[model samples]
Target: MRLCVPRAGDPATATAPVAVEVAAHLLGLVGDPATATVAWDIDWQGPLSVPLTDEHAVQAACGIMHVHGRAAGRPAPLAVDYASTVAGVLAAQGVCAALLARAGGADVTRVRTSVGQAALLALAQYLAAATADGDDPEGCPPSRADAGQELVPAACSFVSADGVCFELEALDAERWLDFWRLLGVDRADTGRGWRSFQQRFATATCALPPVLSATVRRASFTAVRSAADRAGATVLPVRQDPLPPTVTPPWTLTPFPEPGGTTIDRDGTAAAPLEGLRVVESARRVQGPLAGHVLRLLGADVVRIEPPGGDPMRGVPPMAGTTSARFSALNAGKAVTEIDFTTDAGRRAVRDLVSEADVFLHNWAPGKAVRLGLDADDLRAARPGLVYAWASGWGDALGPEPPVGTDYLVQAHSGLAAAVRPADEPPAPSLMTLTDVLGGLVCAQGVLAALLTRLHTGRGARVDSSLFSAAVLVPRGPGRPAATGRPLHTRDGYIALGPRARQRPERLAPALGLAASASADAIASRARTRPTAHWLPRLAAAGVAVTPVCTSLADLARDPRFAPALTVGEYAAPLAPWEFS
Candidate 1:
């Protein structure tokens, strides 16, 4: 379902709303009218590309606001006055707060409807505070007044790997209607207030707002389960053990050994633990390339040997000048080279690289490399000490569809879609590349562990990863089979409650007034009954393990704990001036 909100800037100018316009244009591409649902969340910090209208289109949309601070207060004192667009968004927020207070076992009519203009101003003040003193380390967008730039509404169209696309619209201001009124447009052409305008506006933007979807068919889920049953896929379950209350567990963020009493070198280069390591990567897209890239990050001299035309992912979305964002993210910090393995020269070059390399890695089918004469045996023959790693769709080294596998296919074949999608909705594919990223991480771990073994034993070992394996490894619903089981093994399943959910699901269930059968849906439905301010803190303090579902790497880029992954792209110049004295 499409979750969209109207976007407006301080003044609601025609040219300022390009992002929202682009979003609307993309929504126009979905075709059918009856198959979509629009949920609108208005922002109060940017300009708008599309003008607000009073038409029939917007009435059916679910409205929301991009607000800050308590949902109960009138507009708080702020340094600057927000646009009327922001006011409109706050109105929507107030409406929602009223609805939620009623739903969450609170008095309905007596519920304070304090989320009006005054509440919006209060939110603006909190936005200011959050920016100056609050905990938004991830660098969210700035309000127009703070940036000293024209505020325009922005929006984006997101398509999941499984081909489900949706539009998200963000406005810069909540007092949007006031600004429009100040513009003095003719009453002959326009309607009354902002609410009336929005109700009518929905009709013009979309007959039925788009419902973006990324889901798998139940039939596909059943089929894959059947095939896995035949092939013997393993299922691992969740740990239900309770933690001790008195003793605190020690956790370390550092992953490797540090040199004792060693200071930074004059040139600022840290000593490489695996300095002499040389790796040849035949990985193309994110999964395989990410493995090689990780090795490079850890001080291995990795050469990403691509096909004659380079990896196909180079043409994927988010291109920067000459490279795709995906490619840049995966292949950064590694040396890039091309070879046509089908050609004699290309094959010869790879063999030459392999001869000097300590590790040879690729994400290909089981025996295709052997047929192509680049298999482990062939490489081992040329270079005895080379560790070989291969990532596949399935782990057995051979299967019917041993051709190739991507994240989407794995989500379909594995029961992950069954876990993520809503019960009545079709099984939707996940937006995040959990399989690809996890498989890459696993592949790197395998290669490194094998390398350590090689150092001790003087012989190489083969490391393998499967999209199928990665899919099965991530935790799923409580009643489903644990991912650790043998192929086709059935067991009780449970959902992940995040880091804070350490109170044990069984314990938290009673406090939250939920029974064992209370599903994630029930929890989400209840959570929505209160304002974000009230719920987020309460959940955390109560040790309720919850996290946003289906967030992406782009989203994590703003997170402090996980920001390191986003920095991968900044290493384009390996030995740049910043690295030297």
Candidate 2:
């Protein structure tokens, strides 16, 4: 979003006309939230990447740049206006919750959201790990080898001998070793590489042996595919052709009729939109659990069902008071109960919990639920009016036999990896778990919409959302020609120039003591002659919007702009990405 500059003289506002116009655009209404009715059963298509005034500011302050830049091995922001997209989805969530509240007999009126808070929510896990005590204090990227200036550490997305840049995924360690060994990698290197390769999903840093890339570079994509297939791994080429932009909602809410279903009745206004609602989440990883987390943020009493001894992610790394900070970031406020869902007893236990819950959500593999006799149908039968949400990875788009169906691989398949980088750059997926976070929000959106629909029809819904589906919501348009608003290198530090400053570089040229050639390079060159502090005031005085690039996660805590959205504790966490009035 740093690159998206609103035209000069165009105003930026988040509420009233802008908000009302967006609301109107969504519901075909000329009114505000107060009069919004569940009768419309409003289904959101999507908004174009908004030219938010705080886009880059939020990115810089919230450590999003640090995450993305580190992954790219450069100081970079997402090519897509990701924060604004998240903000838009979050806005839809708030509205849906409000609709649910009104339908529940509460006089709900207004809800609030911001790009800043959405930014925090996007990187909430990463920030938590940074703040949490961990063995790997210095997270990879900005690769420390080159003072963090080198290309991605020779792992992750790789180019085939035929020039096809592709992502390879292997969840099983033996499969990863099998694939690599097929390419004639030494037993020593493959063994070492697997250690970091397995940790990539958790740590977001895959510092593997360069021989892996060298091996892939020498092999044709056909060879690579053959090796993967033989070894039980998945390989997907990063698509250059963009997926057709999504014009429909990211989730599906299919309602089931209930002859004697009951509508919820509330006496007075509650603390939040999802107050009194009970959500039973039996989900693993980011997409499903993060959805539950967002529901928890909206005031749902979320009860997380885990296997006996709890989800193993609790011991992954980066501990915050003995729990995985990343895990706790998504699940901190939820109540948990252990159920060995692999067993008949455990499946029955889960069903019992679902019987008393308003919603039962999960992201189990394709037939795992059915194998256990606990698919959405089973749960909803146990609780007739239950909102059964399946936070899927493939969303039935890939037929019965789907590919890896995880975040990074989905980015490669969905064209997002190609979309997030410039045409000239390699198609590298950001290690920041973008798809998972967005998918989570998409699932939460479906759940809320289903709940709202239930208030009117008194029928529960089957809400399904997927990482692949969520990927399309972020449009792959021709973005800004140059990222002029990204952080520029100053003598002592980096600072970001905002829309006003970037759109009119000539206006900023004089501020930096440069002549008519106020190109991005010129500004950056001159910036390096002085410290970031030296130019910040000068740029501001010259009416060029400027803010420091918060390159460190710890720095964000001290940033006043970031303080409002965060809760400082054993690990840093973001507050609910909304405001209500």
Candidate 3:
């Protein structure tokens, strides 16, 4: 699949992940050849070539594997193909964005992305926290991260006396304290545990006091749930349901009452596809902000709409400058305006902003938009060509009174917990906020698709995405056990073998001075006899791709291959995952 770039010095040809490229040309899509899309599992040519597999992507990117391993209390690989799937989704999104750029008279010719980069993007928040300046900010949660261990134990995903393993969520410390106190926990332990649990979404580690887990361990699931209900918290049992026969796409684009009514009037720019476009984003936490950030990366003018005091997360721990590194990672380079949406005047202010904006986005809980008179109908009435987006926890999936639509709860409810880990390990939700990131990407993708659709229809569309939808995309995969796809344990650290080595283990056995055929245990024992450095070159010489497991995200900046994927600033941040070659 050649991506026919028109510009000289641009990529003359590119291929693999053929659907997007094929769709662009076959559908008579016209964009600067510069905006054509191509994707791959990994770069075909690099300083060093690694095998193309989800395992390698996660391990090398310092991605979700580290967080999953921590939650599972071991150096375990996830059973599902998360990185590759996300990469594919992102590739499709790039195609839509490129097409949108063309409609807006922008020259976007060649878009390139890889599973490795997508994996890095998925771990952006953790990467931010890892490279932040100073200790955690004041009033922040207690962090108990241990750099020495391959997997740090997390006090998330509790099991009840009735054998029900479930996820628990509380947005505020007060509710967290109340829930545990109702469960008969000591006030001191609950206080300490709240810090770790509250920050788990930011730091991938939750070292809660053992007493918290113990308290829940002695209670029935019903009793635990009763406490959560009374405290305005939420608890969801880990479901082991079969994959739905039909999974909904993570987001949908729908034209409103009319079509072919509008086209953006701004002049397009050469530097980025979405340049000159304005995105008015009113969002909290990761999902909505992440969607807006994606647009910012694509060169849109993203104006963040915050409450009067500004987002409280500005002070979240591991500060980069004045704001939390995690917040900076998602919202840097975007403009911010504080509007007290609780007042009618604030709603009017947002409406005024929306009057000239290309996109209006939010991630408020269900029905909040309607209650605030900012629903799609309300705002689109003011600006008929507006692309309205809602990035939420659930997209009308669980009805009006849904359980909190947070990432971990969605994971448990959708059986993602079971899908991500082996059967032997108890169902555990990775603290990496996987669904939230994916949902945000889904939201951005939907918005781009809607924008592209508006090119013909001349009307703006409503886009919706949720963590629940994202979770469904990854059903209960028959995950690999802890024994499968494990890295070789060397004296110094671990080194992951590439797809080629795993596929042809017989060849690898001889390189390790083993019999013609080696059992995994024999090879593991032999590999441990030497240091990681000693084994890497020898394995490479024998045609086995290898890389050190990026157990620590702080070290990711030092890996040469990832240089293009990150920028070392006040804190480390992932670059836009796609490359316009």
Best by TM-score: 2
Rank the candidate models, highest TM-score first: 2, 3, 1
| lDDT (CA) per prediction | 0.39, 0.73, 0.72
Alpha-carbon deviation at 162 in model 2, angstroms: 0.8
lDDT of 1 by residue, 1-581 (tens): 23333334432221212223322332232222311332322232212122122110011000111121011111111111112222222222222222222222333221111112112122211222222222231123342322443222212122334333222111212333222223333332212222222321111111111211111111233432333333333211111211111221110011112111111111212333334467899876556886776566545689888887877766643344466543565576688789988888988899999887878889875667978899876777677766788877666523554423555445545555445332333342333344565566456655655554444445766666666655554434343322210001012111224322433445445435578566655654554455434444555566653432211223322334322212323211111100000
The segments of candidate 2 whose C-alpha lies over 4 angstroms from its true place after superposition are 1-52, 136-156, 244-248, 265-269, 478-485, 518-522
* Candidate with more favorable, higher TM-score: 2 or 3: 2
Task: Please count the clashing residue pairs in each candidate, in the order shown.
Answer: 76, 1, 11
Per-candidate RMSD vs. true structure?
24.1, 5.4, 4.9
Q: Whole-model lDDT for model 2 versus the true structure?
A: 0.73
Candidate 1 lDDT at 541 equals 68
What's the lDDT for candidate 1? 0.39
Deviation (Å) of 147 in candidate 3: 17
Which candidate gets the maximum lDDT versus the true structure? 2
Worst 10 residues of 3 by lDDT: 39-48
Q: How would you encode candidate 3's per-residue C-alpha lDDT over 518-562 as one tens digit per residue?
A: 798899899989988888778778777776776667776666666
- Candidate 2's residue-wise lDDT over 403-508, tens digit each? 8689988888887887776555666788878899999988887787777667666788898889988887775565322434567888877877787766777887
Superposition error at 448 for model 1 (Å):
1.6
